[model samples]
Target: MDFHYHSLPDLFEQLGLPAEMPAVEHFIERHHPLPAAMLLADASFWSPSQASFLREEVLGDADWAEVVDDLNSRLHH
Candidate 1:
């Protein structure tokens, strides 16, 4: 699959996150992937459910892997 956007905010929106630039930026800045990976699906934030969906439905399977990997790369970087 060909994923379009790569920025955290865009990926967030694609993944059904809030997608607000400022908020997304702040979130990425505050939560690094090292921790976000563990906290994403369980965090007390909007990502808990959303992240679970992405991890289980998207990345967990072969479908949407491109976007999921892209988002992961962007989030980690």
Candidate 2:
């Protein structure tokens, strides 16, 4: 069997995540490409905010944690 991989940006596009954050673009440029095809294939779900946290925090600095936390709180509550 053969498998193909897609980057996080491509996966986000496919999954319909908002693509507005430039910081996220810069982040994706530096890190390893995500296993997007696999992530998408999984039936699990993510709230938009959760996905945003993964994108921003996973690739970004610790300072971004504050922003993500604030946003997460707003989203959940």
Candidate 3:
């Protein structure tokens, strides 16, 4: 079966991404759902460093701290 990323980034422009960076084609020859969601659902192409840059740019370090806390809280639950 063929599949493609169908995430918010692909649907909205407010995310500021190129609108075509993320796709299932990179992972599977025939296309498929992302192997994992959390790692692939959001803009799908973000690197760790790039994520940190975006966080710092959009949320600042203090806000990024809260974001981390929130993510940790959700993960632990």
Best by TM-score: 1
Tens-place lDDT per residue, model 1, 7-33, is 556557766767888877677677556
Model 2, residue pairs in steric clash: none
Full ranking by lDDT:
1, 2, 3
RMSD of 3: 12.1
Compose the digit string of candidate 3's lDDT tens values, residues 1-77. Answer: 33333343332232343444343222232223334334322334555665554455335434234434333233333
For residue 14, what is the lDDT in candidate 1?
65
Provide the TM-score for each candidate, comma-separated: 0.46, 0.27, 0.25
Q: What are the per-residue Cα lDDT tens digits for candidate 2 across 1-77?
A: 33344444444454465455564455435332434343311213566655665566535644344444333333333
Q: Residue 46 lDDT in model 3?
A: 59
Q: CA lDDT, every prediction?
A: 0.59, 0.44, 0.38
Name the best candidate (by lDDT).
Answer: 1
Of models 1 and 2, which has the larger TM-score? 1
**Which of candidates 1 and 3 is the stronger one according to TM-score?**
1
Off by over 4 Å in 3: 1-46, 50-61
Supply candidate 2's per-residue lDDT for 34.
35
